[model samples]
Target: MTLHVHSMLIDGNEVAASDGAVVEVDDPSTGQVIATTPRATPADLERALAASARGWETWRETTAWERSAVLRRAAVLLDERTEEIAVVLTREQGKPLAEARAELQSTVEQLDWFADEARRVYGRTVASRHPDQRMQVLRQPIGPVAAFTPWNFPVLLASRKVAPALAAGCSVILKPAEEAPGAALAMATALTEAGLPPGVLNVVTGDPAQISERLIASPVIRKVSLTGSVPVGKHVLQLAAQGVKNVSMELGGHAPVLVFGDADPELAGRMCAAGKFRNAGQVCIAATRFYVQEAIEEAFVASFTAATRALSVGSGLVDGTDVGPLASSRGLARTVELVEDAVTQGATVQTGGHRLDDGPGYFYAPTVLSGVPETATIMQTEPFGPLAPIATFSTFEDALRRANGTPYGLAGYVFSEDLTTATRAAEQLEVGIVGVNSVAVSGAQVPFGGIKESGIGAENGTEGLDAYLYSKSVVTGLRRLR
Candidate 1:
C-alpha cells in the first residue's frame, strides 16, 4: 500500500481537512516526511461528533449478533492487513517493525475477544423482598464515545477502547495522536470495509485541545476515554465531570523494577534492560526505575550497563535494531531535557548519555544514569525514555518506600524467586499492576491502567466494557396481585 502524503478519516470519509491545512508526519529514523495528515479544525471535530450522534441511534439498536459479526470481520481484516498497518505504524511512530507487528496482531485479537464477549454479556435477575416486585440488573450501550488515544501503541490502545465500545453497541469518535494517525486510519478503514455502518466508527486527526474540548462539551457524547500524560488526563476528567460523562483513563506510568538479592542477578538485569528499552523506552509502563538489593547492586549494574550498551539503536525499519528514535521532535527534546537535568543535579552517566550525530533522524542512545538522587527531576517524573536510573537499597521496606514515593504509580515489578518476598512487595506496591520476574505487564486479556496521578479507570478485559456502557437496574411486578 502506498502511503498517502496527507489525509484524515472522518465519518467514514477519507478526506482532507476543510481548511486544506496538512501537518507533516516525519519518520524519526530518517528525519524525512513520510506522510502528512490534516490539521483538523474545530469545524471538523463538530462535523465528526454530529455524524456520530446521528449514527448512534441505529448503532445502539443494532443487535449484539450484528455488532459482533462486524467486529469479528474487522478482526479478520486487521489480521490480513497487519503487515501494511505495522509498516505504517513503524514509519509514523519510531517503534521496531517487530514490535509494531506484535502490537498490531494484539489489536486484532483484542477486537475478536471483545466480539466474543459481546455475545456472553449477561444480566442477572434478583428476587425482591415482596412477591409483587422483582429486580434485574442490565447493561446497555452508553452512547457515542470520544476516544482520545496517545501515539504510543497507536493500534493497540485504540482497539483497547474501540473494541469494547463497538462490542457493547456504542458508536465512537476516535481522536488519535496527530503525530501517529495512519494505523488508526487503517483500522477505521478495515472496519468500514467490513460492513460497519457509516459513522459508527469515526476517526478525527487534529489539535488535542480544540478537539478534546469540543468532544467533552458535547451533550451527545456520553462517554470519554483517554491514554496519555497525567496533566492531560486530569484536564479531560475535569471537563468530563462537567457533564458527568463516563470516562476511562489509561495514563502515564513510572514503573519500578525491584531486583531482590534472591533472584538471578544476570537474568534480572537482562529483563529490566529489555523492558525499559522497548520502543526506545517510550512506554507508560516502561521499567524506568531499577531498585536492587545492596548485595547484588554491583552485579546487576554491571550486567544491566553491558546490556544497555549492546542495544542496537537505528531505524525501526532495520532488521537488527533493538532501539529506535523517539516518535517526534518534541518527544526527543523532552527526553534530552530530563536526562540533562538529572546529570546537572549530580547524577553519574554510567553508559549512554547523548544523541547520535551520525543520523538525520532524532536518535538518542540507550542511556543509564547511576547515583541519581531521589530529589532529581528524572526520579520524580516519568522518564518516558531509554534512560534507566538504578538505586541500591539494603532492605525490603526501604525499597517499598522508595517505590511508593513518587506521585505516579502506574505499574511495579519485582524479580525474586522467593515467593514470600515477592508476594509481600507485590501486595505493598502502590500501583495498579505488578510484575514478578518479568516486565510484561501488558496484554489484551488483562486490565491495565494506573493509580494516583497515573490516571483513572481501566482498559482491556471485561472491566473495559463498563467504560462504554451503563448499568441499569430494572424492577418488575412478578405477579399481578393488585
Candidate 2:
C-alpha cells in the first residue's frame, strides 16, 4: 500500500524533512512498503529543539487542570480511533492485529493515567524550625523533553514518555523508530485534533545518533526519555551527560521465568507460552529464560512445547493469527543464530526450531528448546524473538543463583501456589519487576524500569511524573505576620 504518510510534526504543523529524503517503512509481515517517513536532517533536529523550547514556555504556564484536560481529550480521541491506528501499527511492527489493538487500548489507558496524575503533582510546606519562618516546596515542569521510542511497542511506548512528560507540563520532541514511525505521527494527529497547541508534541523521524546528539546537546531540552536496547540507552546517556541533561531510560531484558516443583506444570506452561510468544517474544520484559525445577521440568517442557507449537504463525493483519513475522531480517537472523547455537551445543529442540519459508516475510515458528546448556549463546544473550530456552534447576537456591547470574535485571517471573513460597521467590529474584504466578509486569500505574546492565531510572507511576519535573524549595521570613 502506498501510504500518504505524514512525515513529521513540528511547531504544531505537519511537515516534511528539510532534505526531502524519506525513510521507507516496510510491513515486516509481508516484506512490503507500508509508508515513508521523513528522515530528519540536522537542521530539522535543531528546529524541533527550538520548537520544543517555545512550546515549553507556554505549556508550563498552563494550569495543571488545563494540561490534564488536553491529555484526557487526546486519550478519548485515541480510543475512538484505536482500530485505524492499530492497523497501521500491526502492519509496520508485525505484531498480531489483536495485540496491536491491545497496544492501542493500552496507550489510551496510559494517556488517561498520566492525565489524571497531572492533577496530583503536589508539593508541600515543611514546618519551620525557626520561629516566624515558613518554608515551602513547589514542583515545576523540568523543561523541553526529547524522547526516543523503540519499534516493538511504538504507540504504547511513545505514550509512556509523551503522556507523562506533557502531563508534567514539559513539551516533547519525539524521535520515534524509523521502522514504525506512523504510530507516533498518528498519535500527534490525534493530540492535535484534541486541541493540543502545536509544538507541545513534535514527532521527528531520522538517524537516531544524529537526532539524539543534537537534541541532547541542546540546552533547551532539559530531559531525555528513551525506550530501546541497552547499548542505545547507554549511548543516549553518554550524550546527555555532556549537557548535564536528566534522562529516563527503559532498556533491554533477558528475563528469567522460574517454575517451582510445587507449581502446577500445566498452568505454568500455559502462562509461559502466552507471555513468551506475545509479539513473537519481542517484548523487553519477555520471559526469555525458563528455569523449571527438576521435579516438574519434564511436564512443563511438554506442556509448554505443545502450547507453543499450537500458535498459528502468519501475517499480523490476518484474523486469528497468533504469531507474526519478526520486525526485521536482523531479528530473524538473531533468532536463527541463537536457536542453531543452542541446538549445536546439545540442546533438544522440543518444537518449532526452524524459520518458516511458506511466505516472503521474516516469519519464525514459535520454538521451545529444552536442556539448554548454561554456556549456550542463547543462554547468555537476549533472544528478542519467538524463541524460549528452558533449563532445569534442582533446588530453589540453585534457581535463584541462575536467575541472578545474568547482568540483566529487568524482569523475572515465578510460579508457586504457596503464598509464602511465591513471596519468597519474588523477593529473591534480582530484577526490577517480578511476576509471581504470572508473567504480567510493568503496568501503567507502577514504576517500570531496571537495574544493572538493563539501564537506569524509571518510567510510569508517580515517579514518572517526577522524571519531567523539578522541585523548588522556598524559605521566607514572616517577621511581621504575628
Candidate 3:
C-alpha cells in the first residue's frame, strides 16, 4: 500500500501547509524521489499548538480506558500493515528489511505496553497526623506536548514518546523527521481511525530546528521530547528552558563493547558483529567501540573480522542482504570521511572500508579497523555507520578508562565469563545502561536514557508515563486549625 505523505494534522485534519512549500523525500536504497511532504511554516505551527492546547482539556478528561482502546486499535492496525510500513522504512532509512520488520513489531509492542500502563497510572495517598487532616498526591497531565523525532528508527522512536504521552492523557503535536514521514503518517492515520479525539494527537512534519524552536518557545506547549544528536538535544534543552518545560531526550551514543580474556571468543565476535551491523550501524546503542583484553585481542579480532567480512551489503529490498545503505548522501559522506581519516591516522584496516559502487544507493561495506589510537577522531565520535574500531587493553582498568573517556554515557557492553570481573566493569562504567555478555538490551519495561552529554530524562516502563505528567499535593484540614 502506497501511503500519501501528510504535512500536517491540525484540529484532527490531515492538511497541507498554507504556503504550499514541499520537501523532497528520497528512497535511500535507490536514490529515487519516493514522495514529498508539506513544508509547514510558523502559521501551521501555531494552528497545531492551538488545536492541541484546546484538545488537552478534553483529552485530560477522557478515560484512561478510552485512550488505551485507541492505542490498542492503533497497534492492531500497525500489525496488519507491518510489511507495508517496514518496506517504506527500509527504503527511506536504508535499514535491512528484517531489521525494519523487527522495529515495526517492537513499535507495536510499545504501543500495547504504554496503553496498558495508561490505565494503571495511579496516585498515592498519605496518612495524616491528626484526624480529618489527610494528605494526598495525584498525577496530572502536563497539557499539550511537542515531540520531535529523528530519521533513524523513525517509527519506533516516535512511538516511544508519542504513545506514552497520549496514553497519559496528554495532547501531542508531533514533528517527525522529514526524511521518513510515511511511518509517522501511517501511525497518525491509525490513531485517527481508532477513534482518537481530533486535536488530541496532531502531527506536523517539516524542518526540525525551525519548527521545534518555535513550538518550544510557545507557552501553549507545556512539554517537549526529542531523539537526536547531542548538539541538537542541547539546543532543544536551551529553548525548553525558557518555559521550564518538561523534556525527555534520547540522544547520541558512542557505545563500547569490552571483550575480556574470559569471554567466549566466538560468541563475543558474533554478538559484536550483529550489533555493529544492525541498521548499518545507525543505531544509537550500536557497539561502535571494541576494547579487547590484550591476551585475547588477536582471537577476538580474527573472529570479528571474519564475521564482518561475510556480511552481504546491498539494497535493503533484496532478501539475504545483511547490510544496507546509509540513510542519505550526507550519511555516506560522513562515514567515508571518518574511515579515511582514521586510516590516515595510522589505523589498520581489517576487512571492509569501501563504498559499494555497484548501486545507486549510498552503500558502504561493514568496516573493522585495529590499532586505532586514543586520539583518533573516530574514537570519540559515533560513526553512525558500518565501521567498528577495535583497540587492545592490558588491564581491565585501562579498558574502563578508555570506554568511559567519551562525553557520552549512553550504553556499554562487556563480554566476560567471570561474574566478579563483569560486575566490577558494569559498576565502573558510567553509562546509564550496560550489557553484560550481550550487545542488545532495550525494552518497553526498562527505563532507557543516557548520562552526561548523552542527554537528559528517561523513557519506557513507568518513568516514561511520568515524564509527560506532573505531581500535585493536596491537604485536607478539620474544622479546627492545626
Candidate 4:
C-alpha cells in the first residue's frame, strides 16, 4: 500500500514548509521510512496563527446551530473513511488494525457528541434582588486554542481537543505528533470538506518544542490543550503561564488494578491482562500495577500469566495479530530497561520478557513480573509499554495505600463482588477514573481527566465542552414603569 504524503494544513490548504524541509515518517512494524511530512518553520507557525485569528473571528460569530451542523457532517465524513484512515493509523502508530479502527470509531463518536453539545451551550437567568433589574449568565467561546496531541492515539486525541473547541465556536491550531501525522491530517481534511471555514482547524507537524513555544507564546492563542507526557505537559504549562492562557492537560498515568480476596481471581486476572496489554500498553490509562490480595495471589498470578502468554504479537497489518510493535525503538528500549530493573530488584518473570528477535520491528514480548518490590523503578515510573508488575497486599488498606503510592493518578480499577469492598476501593483510590469489575472507564459522554500531577482539568462530557468556554455575567437594569 502506498502511504499518504502528509503535509501541514494552513488556511484550509495543504502546503510544505516555507524552507522546503520535511521530516521522515517511519513504519514501526518494519523500522523503515514510509512517508514524509512538512516540517513547519517559524514563518509557517506565524501564518497559522494569523489564519487562526481570522478564523476565530468568523467562527465565534457563527450561530451554535451552524457549528453543530458542520461538526455533525464532519463526523459522518470520518465514519465513511474509517477503514482507509485506519490503515494509515496502523502503519504509522504500530497498533493492530482492529484497534486502529476502534480508535477511528471513537474519534467519530467524539465529533458527534460535541456536535450535539454545541447547541446545548445554555445560558441562565438569575432572579434579581431589586425590582426592574435582570441578571443573566452566558457561556462564550474562549477564543483560539493551541492543541498538542501524542502519537499513541493521534486522531482520537486530536479529535478530543479539536471537536470540543470547534463545537464551542472556537478555532484551533493543532500540532499533532510527528510520528503519526497522516491520521490527524486525514481528520483535518474531513473537517474542511464538511464545510468548516478556512483556518478554523489547522494541523501542523514539526519540532514539538518549536511549535509549542511559538504557538503558546502568541497573543492570539487564548487557550492551550495537550495530551502528552507529564514533563511535556509541565513545559507547556510553564509557557502558558507567561500569557496566563487557559490550559487543559491530560498527562501521563501509571494506573493500578486492585484484586480483592473475595473477587473471582481468574476473571480479574484475565480482565487485567487484557487491559494491560491493549495497544501494547502504550495507553495513558493502562493497568500498570496489579495489586492482588495475598490470599488469591497465586491463582491471580497464574491466570494473568496464561492470558498474557496467549496473546499473538506481529505486524498490525497482519490479520489475527493481537499485539503489534512498539511505536518506536526508544519505547522498545525503555520497556526492556523497566523489566531488567524489576528483575534486579527481586521481581520474578512470570511470563514473557525481553525483546522479540523474530523480525526487524520494534517488538517486545508481552511481559509480566511478580513479587515486584515497592522500590523497583517500574513501580514509580510510568512505563508506557507492555510491562506489568504484580505485587501482593495483605489487606484493603494496604492495597489502597500501595495503589496510591505513586504521584500519577489518572485511572484505577477494582474487581470485587462485595459492594462495600468495591465502593470503598472506588472512593479511596486516588484517581480521576475508577472502574469496578471492569476497565472501561472512558467514553464521549463521561468526564475523563485526573487529579494531582495527572492533569489540571477534565475532558469529555459537558466538562470537555466547558474547557473551551468562559462564563459571562450580564446585568441589565430596566426603566421602572410609571
Candidate 5:
C-alpha cells in the first residue's frame, strides 16, 4: 500500500519521520496497510512550538482581509480538486467516495463562511459611569494553539478547528488522527498553496500521549482544541488544566430519536435508518437510540429494518456502496459486542445481526434491534457503529425521559406533527443541538456542539470563531482641561 499524500509537514516543508519510524494507514474496507505516515518525535514538537511562537508574532499582526483572502483561496483550491482529495479521503478513511466528496464540499463551505466572518470580530465601546472615564471591550486572538483531531471525518473535523483558529488570527499546530492522516496533510498543502506563510499551520501524526503532553506543557501554546472521544476529551481537559489553557472539545455522542404517534412513522423510520448507517454509523452525532410511540413502534421498526437491509455494503470506492466498513477492527468488534448482548438479553434482531464474512475487509452488516432491554450493554454505552437499538414508549414524557437518559448529549432528533410537541421536545432534549423534524444537524452557518459530559464548547457559526479568541476590557480616564 502506497500513500498519495506525503506526511509530516512542519513549517512549510514536507519531511520524513525522525529515527525512520512510520505508522501504517490501512484502508478499513480491505483491512490492508494502505500507507505509512512519518511519526513525529518530541524533538519535532519542540520545533513546532518554536515555529508557532514565531508564526503568532506575524499572524496576529495581519489585517483581517489578508487572513480572509487566504481562507477563500483555500476553499477555491479545494473545490478545484474535489475528486482528487476525496479519493485520498475515501482510501484513507472508509467512507464512500460520494460521502467523502460531500465532507470536502462542506469543509470548503465552512472555510468560505469563516473567511467572510473574519471581518465581523467586532469590538464595542461601553458607557462609563464617570464623566472622565472611557471603556472599550475588544476581542483578540488566543495565541498559538495545539489541535487534536479524530480519524472519523478527518478533513472536515480538522477544518472545523483550523479554519476558525486562522480566521481569528491564531496560529495552529494540527495533530490529526493517525488512522487517517493523509487528508489533513492535504489540507496543509492547500493552505500553503493558498499563500499562507510557513508555520501558520503545521501537521503532526504520531503517539497521542507523547505529542499531547509536550504540546500542552509548552508555555508558548495558549490554546488546545480537540474533536475525539469522551475519555480523550477528559484527558485533554486534565492536561489543559495544568497550563490553565483556553480549550474546545467536541466529544462522543449517543444521540436518541423520539418518534411520536402523530408523526409519519414510515418517514421517521427511513430518516433514522439513513442517519444511523451513514459513514457506516461512525458519526459522533449519529442517531443511536430510537424511542417510538407504542402505537407506531411496530410500524417504525418494520420500515426501519427494511431501509437498513436495502443498503448496499462494500468497499467505499465501489460505484453503489451505501455504507463502508468500520474504521477499525475495534469498531467492528464493538458493534458485534453490542448487538450480541442485546440479542442474548432477548432483544429481537429485526435485520442484519452479523458481520459479512463474504468480503476481505472489516465489514459489518447494518443491524437493527428491537425490544432492547434497558439492561443490555448497548443501551448504556455508545456502539459508534452501524447498530440501531429501539424501544417503545407510551407517552411524550416517557419518550423524552428515555432520550435524555444517556450520559452523552451531543445531538438529539424529534419527529412530531404537533408543533407544540416538537418544540417541547426540543426544549427538554438536554443537547447542544436539537432537530424537531430532522436528523441531519450540521452546517457551516449553524452552531454544532454537545452538553453535559458530551464535552464543552461549540463549533461552526459565529460562536466557533469566538472559541479561538479572548475578550479584553480596557478602561482609561479621559480628561479635558481648560
Candidate 6:
C-alpha cells in the first residue's frame, strides 16, 4: 500500500520544514519505508512556540463551557475518522489493526472524559477567620505545554497529555515520535476542524533532541510532559529545571507478576501471557518478571509457555496476527541482546528464543523462559519486548522483596484467590499501580503514573488536569455588618 507524506502541523496549518528536509518512516511489519514526514527545523519550533503564546492567551480566557464544547466536538470528529487513522497507526507502529483501533478508541474516550472535566474544574470559597474577610482559591492554566510522546501507543499517549492540557485551558505543542507522526497530525486536524483556534495545538516531528531542547528552553513553555525512556525523561527534567517549569513524566517499567499458590495457575498464566505479549510486549506495564509460588510454578510455567507459543506472530495488517514486529530495528536488537544475556546468566528458554526470520520485518517470536535467576539481566532490566521470564518464590515475603528490587516502580500484578494475600500484595508492591488477578490498570478516569525511577507525577483523572493548572489564593476585605 502506498502511503502519503505527512507535514508538520504548526499554527493550525500543515507545512513543511523551513529547510524542506524530511524524515522517512519505516514500517516495522515489513522493514520498508512507508512514508515521510517533514523534519521540524529550529525556525519551525520558534513559530510553534510563538503561536502557542498567542493561543494560550485566547484559550485561557475562554469559558470552561466553550472549551468543553470544542473538546466534545473534537472527540466526535476523532471517532468518525477512527478507521482511517488506525490504519496509519498500524502501519507506522506495527501493532495489530485491532489494537491500533483500540488505542484510537481510548483516545476518543480520553477526549470525551476531559471535555466534561473542563467544566468541572471547580474552585473553592474558603472559610475566613474574620467576619470582614473573604477568601477563595482558584485554579488557572499554567500557560503553554510542551508534550513529548513515544511511538508505542503514540495517539493515546499524545491525547493523555494534550487533552488534559487543553481541558485546563493550556495551549500545547506536541512533539510526537517521528516513527508514528501521522496519528498525532490526525488528532491535531480533528481538533482544528472542531474549532480549536490557530496555535492552541501544534504537532511537530523531526529530531527529538533538537525539538525538546529548544522547546523546553523557550520562555513560552510553562509545562513539560513526557512519556518515554528513563534516560530521556531525566534529560527533559534537567532542561525543565533550568527554568523551573512544571513537569510530568511516565518512564520505563519492569512490572512483576506475583502468582500465589492459592490462585488458579492456568487462568493466571493465560492472562499474564496475553498481557505480556500485547503490542509485541512494547507496553510500559507489560508483565516481565513472573514470581510464581513454588507449589504452582511448574503448572504456571507449562500453561504460560503454551499460551506464548500459541500467539501468531506476523505483519499487523494480516488477519489473525496477534503479535507484530518490534517498532524498529533497535528494539529488535535490544530484545535479542536481553534474551542472550538472560540465557548466559542461567535462564532456560521454555518456548521461543530467536527472531522470526520468515520475513524482512523486525519480528521476534513470543518467548517464555523458565528458571530465570534473579541474577539474570532480564530480572533487573525492562525487556520491552515479547519475552516472559518466570521464577519461583517460596514465601510471600520473598516474592515481594524480589518484585520490589528493581529501580522501576511503574506497575505490579498479583493473582491470589485469598483476599488477604491479594490485599497484602497490593499494599506491599513498590509500584504506583497494582493489578490483582488482572493487567488492566490504565484508563481515562484513573491516575496512571509511577514512582521511584519510573516517573514523576500522574496522568489521567483529575490529577492529570491538575498537572496543567496552578492554584491562586485570593483574599478580600468585606464590609462588616453591611
Could you estimate the TM-score for every candidate? Answer: 0.97, 0.98, 0.97, 0.99, 0.98, 0.99
Q: Which ranges in model 4 have alpha carbons more than 4 Å from their true place?
A: 1-3
Estimate every model's Cα lDDT from 0 to 1: 0.87, 0.90, 0.89, 0.94, 0.89, 0.94
Candidate 6 colliding pairs: none
User: What is the clash count for each candidate, in the order shown?
Assistant: 2, 2, 0, 0, 0, 0
Candidate 5 has what TM-score? 0.98
Clashing pairs in 1: 5-36, 6-36
Q: Which candidate, 2 or 4, has the higher TM-score? A: 4
List candidate 2 stretches off by more than 4 Å.
Answer: none
Worst lDDT 10-window in candidate 4: 1-10
Model 2 poorest ten-residue lDDT run: 1-10
Pairs that collide in candidate 4 are: none
**C-alpha lDDT of residue 377 in model 4:** 92
Query: What does the lDDT read for residue 199 in candidate 6?
Result: 93
lDDT of 4: 0.94
Give the per-residue lDDT of model 4 (tens digit) for 102-146: 999999999999999999999899999998999999999999999
Identify the runs in model 5 with alpha carbons over 4 angstroms from their true place: 1-5
TM-score head-to-head 3 vs 5, winner: 5
Q: By the TM-score metric, which is better: model 1 or model 6?
A: 6
Each candidate: RMSD to true structure? 1.7, 1.1, 1.8, 1.0, 1.1, 1.0
Let me know the TM-score candidate 3 reaches against the reference structure. Answer: 0.97
Residues 207-248 of candidate 1 have per-residue lDDT tens digits of 889889999999989999999998999899999999999888
Residue 165 in model 2: shift from native, Å? 0.5
Steric clash count of candidate 4: 0
